[model samples]
Target chain A: MKYNVTITIALKEGMLNPEARAIQHALANLGFPTESLSTARLFKITLDATDAAAARETAGQMCERLLANPVIHNYTIEVE
Target chain B: MKYNVTITIALKEGMLNPEARAIQHALANLGFPTESLSTARLFKITLDATDAAAARETAGQMCERLLANPVIHNYTIEVE
Candidate 1:
Protein backbone atom coordinates (compact mmCIF):
# COMPACT_ATOMS: atom_id res chain seq x y z
CA MET A 1 0.00 0.00 0.00
CA LYS A 2 1.12 3.51 -0.76
CA TYR A 3 0.84 6.00 2.04
CA ASN A 4 0.97 9.73 1.65
CA VAL A 5 2.71 11.32 4.59
CA THR A 6 2.78 14.96 5.48
CA ILE A 7 5.19 15.83 8.24
CA THR A 8 5.40 19.27 9.81
CA ILE A 9 8.35 20.24 11.92
CA ALA A 10 8.69 23.49 13.74
CA LEU A 11 11.13 24.97 16.12
CA LYS A 12 9.62 25.51 19.50
CA GLU A 13 9.24 29.10 20.63
CA GLY A 14 12.63 30.80 21.15
CA MET A 15 14.42 28.05 19.26
CA LEU A 16 14.22 29.04 15.59
CA ASN A 17 17.39 31.07 15.63
CA PRO A 18 19.59 28.39 17.12
CA GLU A 19 17.92 25.57 15.26
CA ALA A 20 18.68 27.22 11.93
CA ARG A 21 22.30 27.44 12.93
CA ALA A 22 22.32 23.78 13.89
CA ILE A 23 20.64 22.85 10.67
CA GLN A 24 23.28 24.74 8.76
CA HIS A 25 26.03 22.98 10.64
CA ALA A 26 24.47 19.63 9.98
CA LEU A 27 24.15 20.38 6.28
CA ALA A 28 27.69 21.62 5.96
CA ASN A 29 28.93 18.49 7.68
CA LEU A 30 27.06 16.55 5.01
CA GLY A 31 29.02 18.52 2.37
CA PHE A 32 26.39 21.07 1.37
CA PRO A 33 26.15 24.68 2.42
CA THR A 34 23.63 27.42 1.82
CA GLU A 35 22.91 30.85 3.09
CA SER A 36 20.05 33.30 3.51
CA LEU A 37 17.34 30.78 4.32
CA SER A 38 14.40 31.69 6.47
CA THR A 39 14.73 30.99 10.16
CA ALA A 40 11.05 30.31 10.33
CA ARG A 41 9.59 27.95 12.83
CA LEU A 42 7.73 25.77 10.34
CA PHE A 43 8.72 23.29 7.70
CA LYS A 44 6.29 21.22 5.72
CA ILE A 45 7.18 17.99 3.97
CA THR A 46 5.13 15.77 1.69
CA LEU A 47 6.27 12.32 0.69
CA ASP A 48 5.03 8.88 -0.19
CA ALA A 49 5.91 6.07 2.14
CA THR A 50 5.72 2.33 1.82
CA ASP A 51 2.65 1.95 4.00
CA ALA A 52 0.76 3.71 6.72
CA ALA A 53 2.60 2.14 9.62
CA ALA A 54 5.96 2.47 7.99
CA ALA A 55 5.21 6.01 7.07
CA ARG A 56 4.43 6.92 10.62
CA GLU A 57 7.53 5.19 11.85
CA THR A 58 9.74 6.87 9.28
CA ALA A 59 8.22 10.26 9.89
CA GLY A 60 8.87 9.91 13.55
CA GLN A 61 12.43 8.94 12.85
CA MET A 62 13.00 11.86 10.51
CA CYS A 63 11.70 14.30 13.07
CA GLU A 64 13.79 12.91 15.89
CA ARG A 65 16.88 12.65 13.77
CA LEU A 66 16.93 15.86 11.81
CA LEU A 67 13.74 17.89 11.90
CA ALA A 68 13.35 18.40 15.62
CA ASN A 69 15.39 18.73 18.72
CA PRO A 70 14.14 16.47 21.44
CA VAL A 71 14.92 19.31 23.77
CA ILE A 72 13.14 22.28 22.23
CA HIS A 73 11.32 21.15 19.09
CA ASN A 74 8.12 19.23 18.45
CA TYR A 75 6.46 17.85 15.36
CA THR A 76 3.20 16.47 14.06
CA ILE A 77 2.68 13.88 11.37
CA GLU A 78 -0.39 13.20 9.28
CA VAL A 79 -0.65 10.10 7.13
CA GLU A 80 -3.38 9.68 4.54
CA MET B 1 -1.41 41.66 -1.88
CA LYS B 2 -2.14 37.97 -2.42
CA TYR B 3 -1.59 35.54 0.42
CA ASN B 4 -1.64 31.79 0.29
CA VAL B 5 -3.31 30.55 3.40
CA THR B 6 -3.53 26.95 4.47
CA ILE B 7 -5.78 26.22 7.38
CA THR B 8 -5.98 22.78 8.97
CA ILE B 9 -8.61 21.89 11.52
CA ALA B 10 -8.85 18.52 13.18
CA LEU B 11 -10.80 17.07 16.04
CA LYS B 12 -8.79 16.93 19.21
CA GLU B 13 -8.54 13.72 21.14
CA GLY B 14 -12.00 12.55 22.28
CA MET B 15 -13.52 15.26 20.09
CA LEU B 16 -13.35 13.88 16.54
CA ASN B 17 -16.35 11.63 16.98
CA PRO B 18 -18.55 14.42 18.22
CA GLU B 19 -17.05 17.14 16.07
CA ALA B 20 -17.99 15.33 12.89
CA ARG B 21 -21.54 15.26 14.06
CA ALA B 22 -21.32 18.95 14.83
CA ILE B 23 -19.73 19.59 11.46
CA GLN B 24 -22.55 17.71 9.78
CA HIS B 25 -25.04 19.72 11.76
CA ALA B 26 -23.35 22.97 10.87
CA LEU B 27 -23.22 22.03 7.22
CA ALA B 28 -26.87 21.07 7.19
CA ASN B 29 -27.66 24.35 8.87
CA LEU B 30 -25.76 25.93 6.02
CA GLY B 31 -27.84 23.82 3.59
CA PHE B 32 -25.41 20.99 2.94
CA PRO B 33 -25.16 17.57 4.52
CA THR B 34 -22.94 14.59 4.00
CA GLU B 35 -22.02 11.33 5.59
CA SER B 36 -19.20 8.77 5.47
CA LEU B 37 -16.38 11.09 6.29
CA SER B 38 -13.36 10.29 8.40
CA THR B 39 -13.17 11.61 11.95
CA ALA B 40 -9.47 11.96 11.83
CA ARG B 41 -7.40 14.27 13.99
CA LEU B 42 -5.63 15.92 11.09
CA PHE B 43 -6.83 18.09 8.25
CA LYS B 44 -4.99 19.88 5.47
CA ILE B 45 -6.22 23.17 4.04
CA THR B 46 -4.84 25.40 1.28
CA LEU B 47 -6.09 28.84 0.31
CA ASP B 48 -4.89 32.30 -0.53
CA ALA B 49 -5.25 34.93 2.19
CA THR B 50 -4.79 38.66 1.69
CA ASP B 51 -1.32 38.77 3.22
CA ALA B 52 0.78 37.04 5.91
CA ALA B 53 -0.93 38.80 8.78
CA ALA B 54 -4.40 38.44 7.32
CA ALA B 55 -3.74 34.83 6.45
CA ARG B 56 -2.75 34.08 9.99
CA GLU B 57 -5.69 35.95 11.42
CA THR B 58 -8.21 34.31 9.09
CA ALA B 59 -6.77 30.89 9.79
CA GLY B 60 -7.25 31.45 13.49
CA GLN B 61 -10.81 32.60 12.96
CA MET B 62 -11.71 29.62 10.82
CA CYS B 63 -10.33 27.35 13.47
CA GLU B 64 -12.11 29.02 16.33
CA ARG B 65 -15.42 29.36 14.50
CA LEU B 66 -15.51 26.04 12.67
CA LEU B 67 -12.35 23.97 12.52
CA ALA B 68 -11.50 23.32 16.15
CA ASN B 69 -12.94 23.15 19.59
CA PRO B 70 -11.73 25.91 21.84
CA VAL B 71 -11.77 23.42 24.69
CA ILE B 72 -10.33 20.25 23.22
CA HIS B 73 -8.68 21.21 19.98
CA ASN B 74 -5.54 23.22 19.30
CA TYR B 75 -3.99 24.27 15.99
CA THR B 76 -0.92 25.83 14.43
CA ILE B 77 -1.03 28.17 11.48
CA GLU B 78 1.78 28.58 9.00
CA VAL B 79 1.88 31.33 6.37
CA GLU B 80 4.27 31.11 3.49
Candidate 2:
Protein backbone atom coordinates (compact mmCIF):
# COMPACT_ATOMS: atom_id res chain seq x y z
CA MET A 1 0.00 0.00 0.00
CA LYS A 2 1.07 3.53 -0.56
CA TYR A 3 0.99 5.70 2.53
CA ASN A 4 1.16 9.41 3.00
CA VAL A 5 2.49 10.25 6.44
CA THR A 6 2.74 13.59 8.12
CA ILE A 7 5.16 14.18 10.95
CA THR A 8 5.25 17.25 13.14
CA ILE A 9 8.38 17.94 15.12
CA ALA A 10 8.15 20.46 17.94
CA LEU A 11 10.42 21.70 20.62
CA LYS A 12 9.80 20.32 24.08
CA GLU A 13 8.03 22.57 26.55
CA GLY A 14 10.33 25.09 28.23
CA MET A 15 12.81 24.98 25.36
CA LEU A 16 13.66 28.46 24.14
CA ASN A 17 12.51 29.18 20.59
CA PRO A 18 14.03 32.39 19.37
CA GLU A 19 12.21 32.29 16.06
CA ALA A 20 8.78 31.95 17.60
CA ARG A 21 9.50 34.73 20.04
CA ALA A 22 10.53 36.96 17.21
CA ILE A 23 7.31 36.13 15.38
CA GLN A 24 5.21 37.11 18.37
CA HIS A 25 6.96 40.44 18.61
CA ALA A 26 6.48 41.04 14.94
CA LEU A 27 2.81 40.19 15.16
CA ALA A 28 2.37 42.63 18.03
CA ASN A 29 3.92 45.34 15.92
CA LEU A 30 1.49 44.49 13.15
CA GLY A 31 -1.46 44.95 15.58
CA PHE A 32 -2.05 41.30 16.31
CA PRO A 33 -1.99 40.85 20.04
CA THR A 34 -0.48 37.49 20.87
CA GLU A 35 0.30 36.23 24.34
CA SER A 36 2.80 33.70 23.09
CA LEU A 37 3.91 31.72 20.08
CA SER A 38 5.65 28.44 19.38
CA THR A 39 6.78 26.77 16.21
CA ALA A 40 7.21 23.28 14.72
CA ARG A 41 8.39 21.61 11.56
CA LEU A 42 5.89 19.52 9.63
CA PHE A 43 7.05 16.88 7.18
CA LYS A 44 4.83 15.13 4.68
CA ILE A 45 6.29 11.92 3.35
CA THR A 46 5.02 9.41 0.80
CA LEU A 47 6.13 5.81 0.73
CA ASP A 48 4.96 2.25 0.28
CA ALA A 49 4.26 0.30 3.43
CA THR A 50 2.29 -2.78 4.40
CA ASP A 51 -0.31 -0.93 6.43
CA ALA A 52 -1.03 2.27 8.31
CA ALA A 53 0.73 0.92 11.35
CA ALA A 54 3.77 0.05 9.29
CA ALA A 55 3.80 3.52 7.83
CA ARG A 56 3.48 5.11 11.25
CA GLU A 57 6.34 2.98 12.54
CA THR A 58 8.53 3.93 9.60
CA ALA A 59 7.80 7.61 10.20
CA GLY A 60 8.69 7.26 13.85
CA GLN A 61 11.95 5.67 12.93
CA MET A 62 12.60 8.48 10.52
CA CYS A 63 11.95 10.99 13.29
CA GLU A 64 14.32 9.32 15.71
CA ARG A 65 17.07 8.74 13.18
CA LEU A 66 17.16 11.85 11.07
CA LEU A 67 14.25 14.28 11.20
CA ALA A 68 14.19 15.36 14.82
CA ASN A 69 16.65 15.93 17.63
CA PRO A 70 15.64 13.63 20.45
CA VAL A 71 16.95 15.72 23.29
CA ILE A 72 14.78 18.75 22.65
CA HIS A 73 12.22 17.72 20.06
CA ASN A 74 8.98 15.77 20.27
CA TYR A 75 7.43 14.25 17.17
CA THR A 76 3.90 13.22 16.20
CA ILE A 77 3.05 10.94 13.28
CA GLU A 78 -0.14 10.62 11.24
CA VAL A 79 -0.50 8.04 8.48
CA GLU A 80 -3.04 8.09 5.69
CA MET B 1 -11.82 34.19 25.50
CA LYS B 2 -8.36 32.72 25.20
CA TYR B 3 -7.59 30.94 21.95
CA ASN B 4 -4.94 28.63 20.70
CA VAL B 5 -4.46 28.85 16.98
CA THR B 6 -2.16 26.84 14.75
CA ILE B 7 -1.06 27.91 11.32
CA THR B 8 0.61 25.56 8.87
CA ILE B 9 2.50 27.17 6.02
CA ALA B 10 3.56 24.94 3.16
CA LEU B 11 5.20 25.48 -0.18
CA LYS B 12 2.85 25.32 -3.12
CA GLU B 13 3.19 22.33 -5.44
CA GLY B 14 6.20 22.47 -7.77
CA MET B 15 8.18 24.81 -5.53
CA LEU B 16 11.57 23.40 -4.60
CA ASN B 17 12.32 22.86 -0.91
CA PRO B 18 16.01 22.19 -0.51
CA GLU B 19 15.77 21.31 3.16
CA ALA B 20 13.24 18.65 2.38
CA ARG B 21 15.50 17.26 -0.33
CA ALA B 22 18.38 17.14 2.12
CA ILE B 23 16.19 15.38 4.63
CA GLN B 24 15.14 12.80 2.06
CA HIS B 25 18.75 12.04 1.24
CA ALA B 26 19.62 11.81 4.92
CA LEU B 27 16.68 9.52 5.57
CA ALA B 28 17.86 7.33 2.73
CA ASN B 29 21.26 7.15 4.37
CA LEU B 30 19.54 6.11 7.60
CA GLY B 31 17.85 3.23 5.73
CA PHE B 32 14.34 4.67 5.66
CA PRO B 33 13.43 4.80 2.01
CA THR B 34 10.87 7.47 1.29
CA GLU B 35 9.46 8.07 -2.16
CA SER B 36 9.24 11.79 -1.49
CA LEU B 37 9.15 14.33 1.31
CA SER B 38 7.82 17.85 1.64
CA THR B 39 7.96 20.27 4.53
CA ALA B 40 6.14 23.14 6.18
CA ARG B 41 6.33 25.50 9.10
CA LEU B 42 3.74 25.33 11.85
CA PHE B 43 3.06 28.14 14.28
CA LYS B 44 1.09 27.74 17.49
CA ILE B 45 -0.16 30.97 18.92
CA THR B 46 -1.99 31.77 22.15
CA LEU B 47 -4.01 34.94 22.34
CA ASP B 48 -7.17 36.61 23.55
CA ALA B 49 -9.99 36.65 21.03
CA THR B 50 -13.75 37.00 21.05
CA ASP B 51 -14.26 33.48 19.65
CA ALA B 52 -12.86 30.84 17.37
CA ALA B 53 -13.77 32.81 14.30
CA ALA B 54 -11.96 35.84 15.55
CA ALA B 55 -8.94 33.77 16.40
CA ARG B 56 -8.95 32.15 13.00
CA GLU B 57 -9.24 35.51 11.32
CA THR B 58 -6.35 36.91 13.29
CA ALA B 59 -4.22 33.93 12.37
CA GLY B 60 -4.99 34.40 8.71
CA GLN B 61 -3.84 37.98 8.97
CA MET B 62 -0.64 36.86 10.63
CA CYS B 63 0.03 34.45 7.79
CA GLU B 64 -0.59 37.11 5.20
CA ARG B 65 1.42 39.79 6.95
CA LEU B 66 4.39 37.81 8.22
CA LEU B 67 4.32 34.05 8.56
CA ALA B 68 3.86 32.95 4.97
CA ASN B 69 5.02 34.12 1.58
CA PRO B 70 1.83 34.36 -0.42
CA VAL B 71 3.59 33.99 -3.76
CA ILE B 72 5.03 30.56 -3.02
CA HIS B 73 3.36 29.32 0.16
CA ASN B 74 -0.11 28.32 1.22
CA TYR B 75 -1.27 28.51 4.83
CA THR B 76 -4.05 26.94 6.87
CA ILE B 77 -5.41 28.12 10.20
CA GLU B 78 -6.99 26.07 12.97
CA VAL B 79 -8.29 27.63 16.14
CA GLU B 80 -9.19 26.06 19.45
Candidate 3:
Protein backbone atom coordinates (compact mmCIF):
# COMPACT_ATOMS: atom_id res chain seq x y z
CA MET A 1 0.00 0.00 0.00
CA LYS A 2 1.00 3.59 -0.41
CA TYR A 3 1.26 5.64 2.74
CA ASN A 4 1.17 9.39 3.15
CA VAL A 5 3.24 10.45 6.08
CA THR A 6 3.86 13.75 7.80
CA ILE A 7 6.76 14.28 10.13
CA THR A 8 7.06 17.42 12.19
CA ILE A 9 10.48 18.10 13.65
CA ALA A 10 11.18 20.74 16.24
CA LEU A 11 14.09 21.83 18.37
CA LYS A 12 14.16 20.49 21.89
CA GLU A 13 13.38 22.85 24.72
CA GLY A 14 16.04 25.38 25.87
CA MET A 15 17.70 25.35 22.49
CA LEU A 16 18.37 28.73 20.93
CA ASN A 17 16.13 29.42 17.91
CA PRO A 18 17.17 32.63 16.24
CA GLU A 19 14.77 32.15 13.31
CA ALA A 20 11.79 31.91 15.60
CA ARG A 21 12.99 34.90 17.56
CA ALA A 22 13.38 36.87 14.36
CA ILE A 23 9.86 35.95 13.32
CA GLN A 24 8.50 36.92 16.71
CA HIS A 25 10.34 40.19 16.44
CA ALA A 26 8.76 40.82 13.06
CA LEU A 27 5.33 39.96 14.38
CA ALA A 28 5.75 42.32 17.29
CA ASN A 29 6.73 45.03 14.91
CA LEU A 30 3.58 44.37 12.95
CA GLY A 31 1.47 44.79 16.10
CA PHE A 32 0.98 41.07 16.61
CA PRO A 33 2.87 40.74 19.85
CA THR A 34 3.76 37.17 20.60
CA GLU A 35 4.74 35.92 24.04
CA SER A 36 6.96 33.32 22.37
CA LEU A 37 7.40 31.61 19.04
CA SER A 38 9.13 28.50 17.73
CA THR A 39 9.67 26.98 14.32
CA ALA A 40 9.65 23.43 12.96
CA ARG A 41 10.07 21.57 9.70
CA LEU A 42 7.27 19.37 8.45
CA PHE A 43 7.99 16.83 5.77
CA LYS A 44 5.25 15.12 3.79
CA ILE A 45 6.35 11.93 2.14
CA THR A 46 4.60 9.45 -0.10
CA LEU A 47 5.99 5.95 -0.13
CA ASP A 48 5.07 2.32 -0.47
CA ALA A 49 4.77 0.22 2.66
CA THR A 50 3.20 -3.08 3.64
CA ASP A 51 0.92 -1.69 6.31
CA ALA A 52 0.33 1.20 8.66
CA ALA A 53 2.70 -0.22 11.28
CA ALA A 54 5.38 -0.75 8.69
CA ALA A 55 4.96 2.77 7.46
CA ARG A 56 5.18 4.10 11.01
CA GLU A 57 8.35 2.14 11.70
CA THR A 58 10.01 3.29 8.49
CA ALA A 59 8.97 6.83 9.16
CA GLY A 60 10.52 6.66 12.60
CA GLN A 61 13.75 5.42 11.09
CA MET A 62 13.74 8.24 8.58
CA CYS A 63 13.45 10.75 11.40
CA GLU A 64 16.29 9.17 13.34
CA ARG A 65 18.53 8.92 10.33
CA LEU A 66 17.90 12.06 8.35
CA LEU A 67 14.87 14.23 9.00
CA ALA A 68 15.91 15.23 12.50
CA ASN A 69 19.06 15.68 14.50
CA PRO A 70 18.56 13.41 17.49
CA VAL A 71 20.60 15.49 19.91
CA ILE A 72 18.60 18.70 19.63
CA HIS A 73 15.39 17.71 17.83
CA ASN A 74 12.21 15.82 18.57
CA TYR A 75 9.77 14.68 15.93
CA THR A 76 6.16 13.55 15.64
CA ILE A 77 4.87 11.26 12.94
CA GLU A 78 1.42 10.88 11.44
CA VAL A 79 0.55 8.21 8.89
CA GLU A 80 -2.51 8.46 6.78
CA MET B 1 -6.24 34.13 26.98
CA LYS B 2 -2.95 32.83 25.75
CA TYR B 3 -3.29 30.97 22.48
CA ASN B 4 -0.94 28.49 20.96
CA VAL B 5 -1.07 28.62 17.18
CA THR B 6 0.72 26.60 14.53
CA ILE B 7 1.04 27.69 10.94
CA THR B 8 2.17 25.27 8.26
CA ILE B 9 3.40 26.70 4.96
CA ALA B 10 3.77 24.59 1.86
CA LEU B 11 4.60 25.16 -1.77
CA LYS B 12 1.65 25.39 -4.09
CA GLU B 13 1.16 22.99 -6.92
CA GLY B 14 3.42 23.49 -9.95
CA MET B 15 5.93 25.40 -7.85
CA LEU B 16 9.51 24.22 -8.21
CA ASN B 17 10.83 22.63 -5.02
CA PRO B 18 14.49 21.84 -5.39
CA GLU B 19 14.97 21.23 -1.68
CA ALA B 20 12.29 18.58 -1.66
CA ARG B 21 13.87 16.93 -4.65
CA ALA B 22 17.29 16.86 -3.00
CA ILE B 23 15.88 15.29 0.14
CA GLN B 24 13.98 12.75 -1.92
CA HIS B 25 17.18 11.86 -3.71
CA ALA B 26 18.97 11.41 -0.40
CA LEU B 27 16.22 9.24 0.97
CA ALA B 28 16.36 7.09 -2.13
CA ASN B 29 20.12 6.76 -1.82
CA LEU B 30 19.55 5.69 1.80
CA GLY B 31 17.31 2.85 0.51
CA PHE B 32 14.00 4.33 1.61
CA PRO B 33 12.58 4.98 -1.83
CA THR B 34 9.74 7.44 -1.81
CA GLU B 35 7.11 7.92 -4.46
CA SER B 36 7.43 11.63 -3.72
CA LEU B 37 8.37 13.99 -0.93
CA SER B 38 7.63 17.57 0.02
CA THR B 39 8.50 19.89 2.88
CA ALA B 40 6.82 22.67 4.79
CA ARG B 41 7.67 25.14 7.49
CA LEU B 42 5.70 25.14 10.69
CA PHE B 43 5.62 28.07 13.04
CA LYS B 44 4.41 27.63 16.59
CA ILE B 45 3.53 30.92 18.18
CA THR B 46 2.30 31.57 21.67
CA LEU B 47 0.55 34.86 22.08
CA ASP B 48 -2.15 36.64 24.00
CA ALA B 49 -5.54 36.95 22.32
CA THR B 50 -9.05 37.49 23.50
CA ASP B 51 -10.49 34.20 22.30
CA ALA B 52 -9.90 31.37 19.87
CA ALA B 53 -11.52 33.34 17.11
CA ALA B 54 -9.35 36.30 17.80
CA ALA B 55 -6.26 34.15 17.78
CA ARG B 56 -7.24 32.51 14.51
CA GLU B 57 -7.86 35.86 12.92
CA THR B 58 -4.51 37.19 14.00
CA ALA B 59 -2.69 34.11 12.78
CA GLY B 60 -4.38 34.27 9.42
CA GLN B 61 -3.34 37.86 9.12
CA MET B 62 0.20 36.95 10.02
CA CYS B 63 0.35 34.48 7.16
CA GLU B 64 -1.22 36.86 4.69
CA ARG B 65 1.25 39.62 5.53
CA LEU B 66 4.46 37.82 6.37
CA LEU B 67 4.69 34.13 7.15
CA ALA B 68 3.48 33.00 3.72
CA ASN B 69 4.30 34.46 0.35
CA PRO B 70 0.67 34.00 -0.78
CA VAL B 71 1.89 33.48 -4.36
CA ILE B 72 3.76 30.23 -4.43
CA HIS B 73 3.11 29.10 -0.88
CA ASN B 74 -0.07 28.26 0.98
CA TYR B 75 -0.54 28.07 4.72
CA THR B 76 -2.83 26.40 7.21
CA ILE B 77 -3.34 27.68 10.73
CA GLU B 78 -4.25 25.72 13.82
CA VAL B 79 -5.04 27.41 17.11
CA GLU B 80 -5.07 25.50 20.34
After superposition on all CA atoms, how large is the RMSD of candidate 3? 1.0
lDDT (tens digit, per residue) of candidate 1 on B1-60 = 544444444445555465446644654455333332223333233435557786577557
Stretches of model 2 off by over 4 angstroms after superposition: none
Whole-model lDDT values for every prediction: 0.52, 0.92, 0.93
Q: Each model's DockQ?
A: 0.02, 0.88, 0.88
Model 1 lDDT tens row, A52-79: 7876886677557554677876677777
Docking class of predicted structure 3: high
lDDT string, candidate 3, B1-80, tens digits: 99999999999998999999999998888989999899999998898999999999999999998899999998999999
- The 10 consecutive residues of candidate 1 chain B with the worst lDDT sum are B35-44
Score every model by TM-score: 0.33, 0.95, 0.96
| Over 4 Å off, model 3 | none
Q: Judged by TM-score relative to the true structure, which candidate is superior, 1 or 3?
A: 3
Interface RMSD for model 2 amounts to: 0.9
Q: Could you give the CAPRI-style class of model 2?
A: high
lDDT of 1 at B18: 58
Q: Pick the candidate with the highest TM-score.
A: 3
The candidate with the higher lDDT, 2 or 3, is 3
DockQ computed for model 1 against the true two-chain complex using alpha carbons: 0.02
- Candidate 3 chain B least-lDDT 10 residues: B23-32
